[model samples]
Target: MTSVWVGERVRLRAKEPDDWEAFHSFEEDSDAVRNGWRLHPPSSAAYAKKRTAEEAEQRPDLDDPDLVIATRDGNVPVGSIGAHHSDRDHGTFAYGISVGTPYHRKGYASEAIVLLLRYMFFERRFQKAEAWVYSSNDASLALHRRLGFVEEGRRRRSHYANGRYDDEVLFGMTIEEFTALHT
Candidate 1:
C-alpha cells in the first residue's frame, strides 16, 4: 500500500545527518532564501551540518518537525517542508516549503505539499492550513493559488526585502475545502 508520506514524485522523510550538503546548498541560493522566507546572513557548511544533527535529534520533541523532500526514485534531497505556528486548541497551522532551484517546476513541491496536508488534516486533525507568501515571491503565490488556497488577506508592507518592503499575502484552506478538492 502507498504510504501517507509518499506522493507522486516526492516523499517526506526525516532529516538525516548526511542531509547537511543539501541543506547547505539551499542556503547558498539567494533567490530561494529570499522568496521562501526572510533572508539572513550566510551560514557555514560546518554550522549546517551541526544544525541538521541537532534538529534531527530534537525532532521527536517537536509538534511538527521539518521533513526533507526527496525524490521517490533515488531518494535524492530536493527541498524541505514543515508545519509551524500550530495552534492545537484552534485546530489551525501554517507551513513553509522550499524546493531547490534546480528542482523548480518539477511537481516535487506540489506533491510534497499534498502529502503534508493530508497528514495534517487526517492524522494530526488540523482543521485549517495557512501559508504566508511574500509579494515578491511570484512562484509561491501562484503555487498556493493553483493548490486551491484562497487569498484570505494581505499584510501590506510588512515584509522588507531587497531594500524594499513587500506585502505578505495570507492564504488559507479548511479541511472541508481540502477534502472537496483533493479527495
Candidate 2:
C-alpha cells in the first residue's frame, strides 16, 4: 500500500472497500455514533453502498480526498481523514479516529491529522484548511488548537444534535502557517 504521509507512529493511505467492515465498526461505536452528526445508528446499513461508491469515485485532483490511517505494526486501518474544497483555493476537512474502543487516546488522531495537513498543504497546494467542530466536543477542539487550527468563526445554533441545538466552531490553518510550523 502507498503511504500518503509517514510520521512517527503511523502512515496515511488510500481507503479501500475492503475497509468497509472496519470503517463501519468504527462508525457504529457508541461514542462515534453519537458524535458523528451525519452517521446514523450502528445497525443501520442503508447508505453503506452509496457512501462507498461515492468515496470510490472521488478524484484527488479537486479535493474530496479521503485517507486511512494505518499503524506501523500490521497496517490495519485505525482511523480516517477527509477533505473537500468548499471553494477554489479554500478547503474544509472532517476527521475522526475510529481506532476501535481499544485504541482511543493513543495518538492516532494526531498522527492522522498531521499527515493530512501535510498532504493538503504540500501535495494538494491548498491555501487554507478548515475543520468544523461541535461545541461540546472538547477533545476535538483541543486537538485542533494543538494543530494550529485557530477558531476563525462560529455558527450559533447551527446544528441540532442529540435533541438539542449545538454550535459549530470553525477552525482554520493556512498553507504558509503549516509550512512554517513544520519547519
Candidate 3:
C-alpha cells in the first residue's frame, strides 16, 4: 500500500530524504527526549536504509513502514509513527510514535495514530495493534486511552530513563475493536 494516509488535520506521508532535517530535529529535542522511551540519536543513513528495505517488501504492512506525520496543507513534518516487531503471519504489531515538541496537544499524534491503525487493520490484515507506553508519559497514556486502546499489562521498572526506571504500560487494540471504533 502507498505510504500516504490523509486525516482531518494531519497526513502520514512516506519518509522522504527531504524530511531528514525535520525528523532529526524532533529526535534531538530535549523535551521530546524526556518523554520518549528510546533515547538514542537517529542516524540519517540508518533512516535511508530502513526506507529502502520497507519499499522492497513484497507484502508490506504499511504500518511497519515508518512515516512522517505532517500537516495536510503544507505537509510540514511534525511527528512519526512506525510498527516494529510486526508479525504479519500472526496478524500482530507493536508500534511507536511521537509528535514534535512544538506540536503537542494539537491532536496531531492522535490523528496520525488512528489513520495508521486503520491502515494496519483494514488494509494490511493485521489482527491487533499494540504499544508500550512509558508509565510516566501521561500524554501518551491519555492518547492511547482516548483512541480506544485497552491496557493489556505492565512491566514494572522495565525502562531506564532520566536516571531512573519507569514502568512500561502495554496497550492493544484488536481488529474487531478497531472496526467497532471506526465504523
Candidate 4:
C-alpha cells in the first residue's frame, strides 16, 4: 500500500526523518499519556533524535507513517492515527489529537477515527478492527459507538493503572458491517 493518505481535513503519510520534533512533543505530553496508556515517558529532545533513527529501522504504522495532517493553513500535525499488526490482516490502531497542550476537547479524534476506519475497512482489506478503551473513558466509548463499532466484550478489572484495576472495553467492527452501514 502507499505510504501516504489524505482525507478531507487531515493526511496520513509515512513518518519522515523530519518529524522527529513532532514525535518528541507527542511523547512528552504526560496528560496525553494519562488519558490513554503510554508504556514510557519520553524526554522531548532525546526522543526526537531517537525517533528519527527508529523510523529508519522500523516499519510504519498508520500513525507513524511519514504522515502529517494540518489545517491547510500552517501544515502542522494536530495528532496521529494509525495501526500496528502482529500478523497479516490483523492489527490494532491508536489515534488521538494534540494540536497544543490545551486542545483536548476539540473533535480531532473523531474525525481522525472516521478516516482511519474508512482506510482500514476499504483500503486495508481488514476483516475486523478492534479498539480497547479504558472503561472510564466515556467519550471514547461514545465515539466508537457512533462509528458503528459494536461493544463485543470487556475484560473486567483488566488493567492496573493509576492505582486501580480498571476494566477495558472491547469494541470491534467488521468490514461487512461497516460496508453495509455505509451503503
**The candidate that achieves the highest TM-score relative to the unseen native structure:** 1
Off by over 4 Å in 1: none
**Estimated TM-score per prediction?**
0.95, 0.80, 0.84, 0.74
Q: How many clashes does each candidate structure show, in the order listed? A: 0, 0, 0, 10
> What alpha-carbon RMSD in Å does predicted model 1 have with respect to the real structure?
1.2
Pairs that clash in candidate 4: 13-66, 13-67, 14-65, 14-66, 14-67, 15-65, 15-66, 62-82, 62-83, 63-82
- In model 2, which runs have C-alpha deviations exceeding 4 angstroms? 1-4, 43-62, 89-101
Model 3 C-alpha lDDT per residue in residues 4-50, reported as the tens digit of each score: 38977898876666666666677667657767766775567677556
Q: Write the per-residue lDDT of candidate 2 for residues 1-183, one digit (tens) a residue.
A: 556577778877776666666676776566555555555644545466557557766665435566777786777878777765546534544444445655667888877777877776677666787788888878788988987878999999988766777789988888787777765
lDDT value, residue 43 of candidate 3: 67
Between candidates 3 and 4, name the one with more favorable TM-score: 3
- Local distance difference test, each candidate: 0.89, 0.70, 0.81, 0.61
Question: In the order shown, what is each candidate's alpha-carbon RMSD?
Answer: 1.2, 3.3, 3.9, 4.1
Candidate 1's residue-wise lDDT over 1-183, tens digit each?
879889879989998889999878878888788888777898888999899998877644245758999999999999999999999999999999999998999999888988899999998899999999999889889999999999999999998778998899999999999999998
lDDT of 3 at 18: 66
- Which run of 10 residues does model 4 get worst, by summed lDDT? 63-72
Candidate 2: give the clashing pairs.
none
